[model samples]
Target: MSTQQEQLDFIERHLVYDIFKDFGPEASLEFHKVECSNGLDGFMSALYTVTLELVIRERKRTEVVLVKFMKGTEEFRESSNSYIQFANEIFAYAEILPAYENVLRTSHLESEVVSNWVPRCYFARFGQVEGLSNGRESVLALKHLKNDGYQLGPRLILRRDHLEAMVGLIGPFHALGYATRILQPQVHARLRAGVVDMPFVSESGKAIFDVLYRVAFDRFYEFYDRQKEQLLKDTDPGFGAAIERLREKYFKQPTQLLEWIRTNSYAADQADSHFATFLHGDYNRNNVLFHYGADDKVDGIKAIDFQELRFSTTAIDLSFFLYMNTASEGREEIYAELLRKYHSHMIQMLELVLRRNQDELTDDRGAELLKEYSFERFNGHFKRYAFYGALVCMHFLPWLLGNEKDCAELSRLFDTDMHGPAFHQLSMDIAGDEANEEIFKIVRHAYEHGYMDEI
Candidate 1:
């Protein structure tokens, strides 16, 4: 373990010094190591450094900044680098900033255009370090919104207002991608190549997917086996049929399903004639921070976690937010309205991108792209991919819900000898009636859309 003095020494060498020079000889810093009993895979610690200043300076003020440090195991560190490389590839066409100026300017311009919908980026940087065998680190310094707070993670239920705010932000974020396509066509093309035709098909991603699918299948069977009686007694006949049909199709023929996935994994690799633009791959509520007033209505929203940014269909982002955020009981009622809102915002932004960069993309081509890649068409893909999404939800829900007990059983079923089964089990335990209903709704939506047709 790194001692307090050792940590302080590391900080003295790394942190900007002019900000800390004012502290008297007796002034000391405080360190707090946050325990993520919640079972997340990362090392997070918050440092609160307080210093007293002399009277000589024109500004005699105390300085306090919260530094959140995240570190990973050797394997995880390597994986994080690969992830950063992927992000860098997406931004290759655009200028990436070590300072906040460029990102701030871009964000301000976007906010003005979109009005009520933009996230603020404070600072971002990538550099090498001496610790852990001189590995590189990517650090993002963000404005700490003490007043604004975040809701529960994606697994939890989302309020109507929360849903509305999130949907509103999607329009402008997607528009930014479209704008990039027009203003920087060549860059956009590069991003398209890098994002859609991801090396996942060829790289370690193939092995990762192979393992993930097998684990997913095994878990599905365990869940099915354990809940067989309950499934038979399910009140909704349609729901029972859907589950059984899925089991008969996928459970008995796991290899066939895996083969099918392997075949279609490259389906979106080729950028179709449809519109392609920048996409926030994991645009869930968890990544969206909400600013709420006394009334609990959303005043502002900012997005975090750019780890999954890529170039692809706008619908991919929209569907992720919708499926992950919305609950079961009210989803059908709000789905149409939310979809309409997303479309309207997207078209408006698309128009802006075209108008600003007339030479790059003609109005006709832009409109054609927009129409071809409309949300309606994309929803079809969402329905088809809903099973995969559900599988992901099932696997992680226990951890998210803070159910640690059943995590071991869940892990064993997945054929992974890793720890943290308890955390996943805790998550499953915490998922209340509302979450169950939400899961059912998603499954029903898939069924109604004929997602199980082939089965």
Candidate 2:
């Protein structure tokens, strides 16, 4: 094993200098300070921040970059089918992102680069693309967002401004794929064919989800048992049984729907092709970071953890983000506006990108994309597909919303392949916390909307 100092030295020389030399001809790296980092809900990667002190043209400056080494052990990687995840992430950062930015650069309308929405990946390597990796020694480096004043919001906190900022970006994130299809069909085709959403599609993938699902159910039951007495005290004599029956019926629907999705994920329904786009797939407070201005308002955001990224209907990204971060009430209020924002922006991007290539798409033909892609068509798919958002929340929220200790404990257990009674107890504490009211809100929204019935 490489010692920590040796690794830092390698990173500073091989990684940091390569990324920073572009700062200027006179730019020279003094050194880099490496610090480890992990979020409460972060369980997938070994992360670190490398701050480099550089002198550029006689001026001293400090630049911070992030480095992510693959974290899944051989067995864990095999069981999770993370090979596909790693491949997709590396493909996105290395291949897809640059092409997307190129489309914008050649467009008629002014556009921000992909790095504005996602971090600027300085370097990335994974199996099958840049060479080979055995789920180890895979490395990705990127400009650290914290260096740009971005911070992760609380796991359960849902501020409207933050949601709006994120919703605005989701449009362009997916829009780039649409634009690429129109502007660079060959490149788009290459990417669509290359990336695979295999995390939950294979038998091993299904097994890992089953383990997580089992833990969610067990913890909820434990919490329910612990709270049943007081829960009944404030209710009618027969209310306890009524709730127990409802609860049993309630959770099962998502389990069924989630299993259904595992079978039908990334389904390219012809009727919904116009609305099909890339999905961030995983979007929680952990995966998205926000930058606030001096007025304490969110003006910008960045998305990370493209491990679950895939090409799918836009609803998957939209609903997953809103439901994961916003409670039912908050989501319902802004949901329509968010849908409008994403659709409009996506269409706008498509129009602007095709403006110069009238032979490919004319003003009349460009406008037809909007005519063909209607809000009603898009919203209908969202209603049918919104359950995906709820189900992901169900499987993950129990552990993600837990306290710091719970996250650390869960990570250790997950890494060691030891999901035992001890794991159950930690999950019970997480699921049982009285503050976990939002999970019920997610369930109620799905139940009220008949998401379960659709399955």
Candidate 3:
């Protein structure tokens, strides 16, 4: 293991020099001081908060940046089917977001604008570090949003306004994808081509998924059994059977829909035109940071962590946010309202793109175009992946809701093997948390919406 000083030395010599060279000659940028501190711990990367005192072009300034490094253990990095994750993150920061913004900037959309919903990326490199070889030393430097008054939401339960704030951000994000598909077909195609094939579709990922599914399903069923009385009483009579059927058909098999998504993930025929945009595959409460306004209410939200970006429907992002963060009470109360707002923003953004494209609204062609990009079509695709929403909740809620100690233990346990008994125990512990009712609400919603039958 490298000493702390050694790591600091590496940052100063390599990272700092790279940033300085971007502006002008190295001498033009004088570095005076540097300090580094631990950042938020992620599952697959180590983050550092690097502060720098510098003079550039006679202007003295202090800069703080968050550096993400693929510094996981060799065993975990190699074993977890992480080959494409780093590349996916780098692609999102370096290419995808910029392309989306460029589409907006170049368009004649008088009413709409592209907001910076994610942190500004300063630099991204793969296979740069000398000793951290085999693509393990990938690094990303991003503006530290926390320095600008952004903070994480309470992980236990997200409030209604917080959920709305996130919805507001994601709505435009998905709309960009829809707009790009219509306005700049070539750009959209290029982005679609670049979506990293989810590791779970591969042979090794298949093995991992097998183990992961078994343990995840076991925990899920255990949670169901524990709450059988209340859930059956409060939910539809079909709840218990639907859960069991999904376990057997989807989780046990694991590929029924996996193959479908893989085969059709990128196909863009009008018949099944659901795969429209680059989705933040890991949209959750922890991945979003909130900016509080003067009233102490959340006024803005920014997303972080792009390792799970996928060329999929907006529903994937929407369902993940809704099920993962919002409590049952909040979801039940505001689910329709949230969807309506998200759909409205998406339509507004799409209209801007349509206007820029100069597509005639009175003609049959324009009507077809609007229908193709309609919210009803998007809802159809979202419901199709409702099974995935529930599955992700079962696999993720444990870690998200666990206490610090439990989270640490759970992370350490699952980092190596997915099917270990200890993993199931920890997952069960997570499902047993009272917060699980929130997730159950998601599952219940899915069933009520006929997602259970469709899956």
Candidate 4:
């Protein structure tokens, strides 16, 4: 059968037949692709936007759903561990999202309604499908959000307004996870059961990180050499020593540095476990869509791509956005203000969950809860976040700022040494392409604040 035929049969078996039987006995269904693209992120999945046309009772109607299918190549499977990514994404749609909504509904708060903050899934299935020789097909079909007036954020540079809108949306997303944990512990456990630990901690992920870490060390040293005379003149004699220490961390103990990052990245109330949440792990500009209003200003945001979701502290999600999305000048000016805004919304989301359980938060009660999962205390690991930002610039910035041709080269990433001249130049080019200053400022700020003392 043709690919289209296979897809039609798949949809009918999974979705249309059940609904159409009620619409009319003589109903018929057909679907055609409206848009198709290889995923920009390179590893998790490829996308196809299709419109399903249904005719029944002498009338016709249409529904559009975006289908995400796991990349079927062995290269992707081996390099990124596609199975784990697919499992997390499928579990996110099938289990986590529903549990989050249930928590909201039970809370009886203003935010109780299932909002458009995340796309609605029409159908999600994983495991065997008849057609493919591998017999494995993992797919998620969600409502076409663009049809509802959402637009992708700019790829190269994000505006201050756009960054604020993302923080506004993601803050509640993280809070909802926390509220679910407090109010619906059983459901929270179920959600956690579906997610694996952070992938970078895995052996394969660490191998990749090792390469990028070296490149980042070199990138920093190259910057220092370029500014050595000026830096020494402006600061204490130990300025060069500090940079040398950073270089040594990446060169001699890259794995230990990663461990340091992971260890301090989360906090625990007692022993063994940290305050955890379902994270939108790849929370960058491309993964977020904005809904615009009368003046073409952003009114709201909808986050996409949950393949990287993991159970982690709020700081992981919060810091990823701050580091990846905001510019240096703007980030320093609004850093504390933006964090406060996110923390405030997090509290509001938790309040709604509290209301659902007939537990109102008095000032003392709120203070105690805050102390238990203190935003300020948790975020005190700003150096870890800054470290993560620098590392991403070593690798991700190239792809983020690359053209289609550049992204194609990324598909062969593991075959090449990331610290080699070709890859190093690519990183430098992307950094010089208006991306380096922000990361430098973030790292320097961390040093100035003594946030790196723990490491």
Q: Which model scores highest in TM-score?
A: 3
Q: Which stretches of candidate 1 lie over 4 Å from their true place?
A: 1-11, 17-70, 78-123, 127-133, 147-155, 190-216, 225-276, 310-316, 359-363, 381-388, 403-441, 451-455
Q: How many backbone clashes does candidate 2 have?
A: 0
lDDT for every model? Answer: 0.49, 0.68, 0.69, 0.63
Worst 10 residues of 2 by lDDT: 127-136
How do the residues 45-134 of candidate 2 rate in per-residue lDDT, one tens digit apiece?
Answer: 667788889988788888888887666656677666566677788878888888887887776444577767888777887753222232
lDDT tens digits by residue: candidate 4, 303-354: 8887777676555576667766766666666766777787777777766566
TM-score of 3: 0.87
Task: For candidate 3, list the clashing residue pairs, or say none.
Answer: none
* Local lDDT at 330 for model 2: 60
Using all chains and alpha carbons, the TM-scores for the candidates as numbered come to 0.67, 0.84, 0.87, 0.83
TM-score of candidate 2 on Cα atoms, chains taken together: 0.84
lDDT of 1 by residue, 44-118 (tens): 222333232333334444333333333444454343344454335224322322111222244344434432332
List candidate 3 segments past 4 Å from native. 1-10, 21-40, 56-59, 108-115, 127-136, 199-211, 226-230, 255-270, 359-364, 416-419, 431-437
In model 4, how large is the Cα lDDT of residue 33?
40
